[model samples]
Target: MQLFAYLESFPILHIFELLELTLAIMIKRLLFEEAEITAREFKIVAITGPRQSGKTTLCKHVFKNKHYVSFEDLDILEEADSSPRSFINKYKDGAVFDEIQRVPGLFNYLQTHVDKVGKNNQYVISGSNNFLLQQNISQSLAGRAAYIELLPLSLLELQEHWGNTKNPVFFMMNGFYPSIIAKQSSAERWLPNYLKTYIERDVRMIRNIENLNLFSKFVKLAAARSGQILNVNNLANETGVDNKTISAWISVLESSYIVYRLQPYYNSFNKRVIKSPKLYFYDVGLLCNILGLNSERAIKQSNMYGAIFENLVISEIKKNRFNKSQYGEMYFLRDSTGNEVDLVLEKDGNLIPVEIKSSAKYRSSDLKNLKWFQRLYRIKGGMLINQSTENQELEDGIMNIGWAEVANV
Candidate 1:
């Protein structure tokens, strides 16, 4: 609010001066267009993401005309839980429901109401818990609701306001959480509390875990394993838990949007590829916090620097894809002998292998895997995302683009 007030208080002459220099523009989420389009096509639209990712803010901004209701209020939850039909009827015209997963049974009443009315855009619902929200959607609003996954700010979204002066490593350490970035707060101070709340609230709501300490340790251990192939047995040994428990915790992490498990590309061409999936954090800043790296110097000098950079690139690409409403499959390719492509993006029925390197200088040897994968699969093009400032074309139709340029693709 202060940010807006400060902008409004700026002299009108200065505002026009900034506009003439093409420096003034509205700071908005790229997913706004996708959500607005979905609202027009479906009777119910569901926005889901991690806690404090600005889902509620985006919903309120897009559906401002609709009456806003949040289940976080105990009174509203009580009313909805007791009389689901009445709650539905009260907002028969249209409404935006925040944290709808809090009352799963309400979805049934919503389904009946929308069916009777046979109208589009009757309700917009959002929740942070994907497991519970998706379960309710599958049971009640299967064909009626369109889904959108919103992550934190991507580089493209941030460049709208901050420009391109910041580097990839800078974001890798501080992350793209909107509230922290907007307030210019220290990630070290904010992310720990955010992680604590997620563990205390969302995890308990999702599954019964008697040992919060053990679960917290499991999360930190998983963070240390970012950008590496997931090993359930190793994690079990390290966390003093069984493989089953480790697997379950990983599922909980993914469902809560704390981590992502990138499955390996198994479509082999006369070679045995690694079948295990790679683990990556949804936000690298959270990963850094979990590892106790509070400073840029600590992050750059840590042994996990390469892993952090890799996670940053992959997660940024993932966020950009979601922002653009691209729901395509993305995977990593690794063979038995350790030849691998960091990422494989599925678009238009073709697999484009991508090589991710933390090096600032381009080298021909880095493109070896990209060329090999292209020739083996008979693919025409591939991408190499690195820290370089320049873009160039290499052998075998492969293009080397800077990390910030991922938003464009």
Candidate 2:
């Protein structure tokens, strides 16, 4: 029988199962395309991202025919730890090593193996802790490995896999972790557990913190301050820790991919720009969880609604750029005089200033900062990203893009 006829002949429940399975296989990750291209040019490819950000799934999916081994297996880790050379020899044909940070010594052996073989795409390595993975790469696998960051699912990926919906508010509140979408799990249950696992295990492994409670408090405080300029002194006072300590903790969070700091854009013409970097969480769902926002209604009514919206847009831009194998430098343009542009994307010598808003209505004042930025920089175009559904060209070069259409912009 033909495929459609055969599927139709199955019971209703069975058809649903078949459809789910098909979708599970058909879902293509944005990074997977670039990863495959990188693998062809490098001896080794290292995929690093936050834990549970679909690193394992992306690597496996892209290199489906390759042998796979995970260092997370205690016995395998012990074996690899004891005899790195021997363990590497066993996968001489090439293999995917998941969580290779757990086996740091293996990098030296892999380096030797790749040096002798001199083959492209001979080994695929993945890790959740970028600091450890990057250190190992720099020390042992430099000039041999192609580093690719796989952040959480982008809005484009979500739209491609799951049909686009009108309710972006729901997505912003829930965030875009792959497993949460694949399993249709509740963010309330998943995010808390994710936070606990990351804090109790990953943080401990990365740093030696005496008081978990204090670290947890610091994380929450940082989340509360998301989208605001990072002030180490203020954070130190709020957390009751020294500025140096606060800086160290924030570094740990940044290295672990928990948060990202958007540096301010300063030019000769704009000498008044603030030098401080702005803080934003990599995942808004985790931010919401940290802030104890349990429902969509709460998020909508909260005073931080605009900041959270800005955070989502900025992160999406970052993810989209990374997925395309482009290291687009993103910054916020703000001056001491209080003139600010929410996001400034610098690519190919052109600066694209983006202004973000949570409201559906577009006002002339919304583009005030963008227009000023254009005049100062002598730029022809900019964008105003907001919740409005329609895309409009409000002026000669200023375009008002809706939140859903941000990926395309």
Runs of candidate 2 with Cα error greater than 4 angstroms are 1-24
Best by TM-score: 2
lDDT per residue for candidate 2 within 26-120, as digits (tens), equals 67777777888899999999999998787877776789888878888999999999999999999999999999999989999999999999879
TM-score each candidate. Answer: 0.92, 0.93
Candidate 1 residue lDDT tens string, 1-409? 9866876988976553333222112567888888889999999999999987878777767787999899999999999999999999999998999999999889999999999999898999999999999999999999999999989888888877777649766786788887667654578788999999999989999999989999999998999899999999999999999999998889899998999999988864555899999999999989999999888899889999888988988898898888887768999988888789999999888898999888899998999999889877887789998989999988878899998888787
lDDT of each: 0.87, 0.87
TM-score, candidate 1, is 0.92
Superposition error at 185 for model 1 (Å): 3.0
Error of 1 at 71 (Å): 0.8
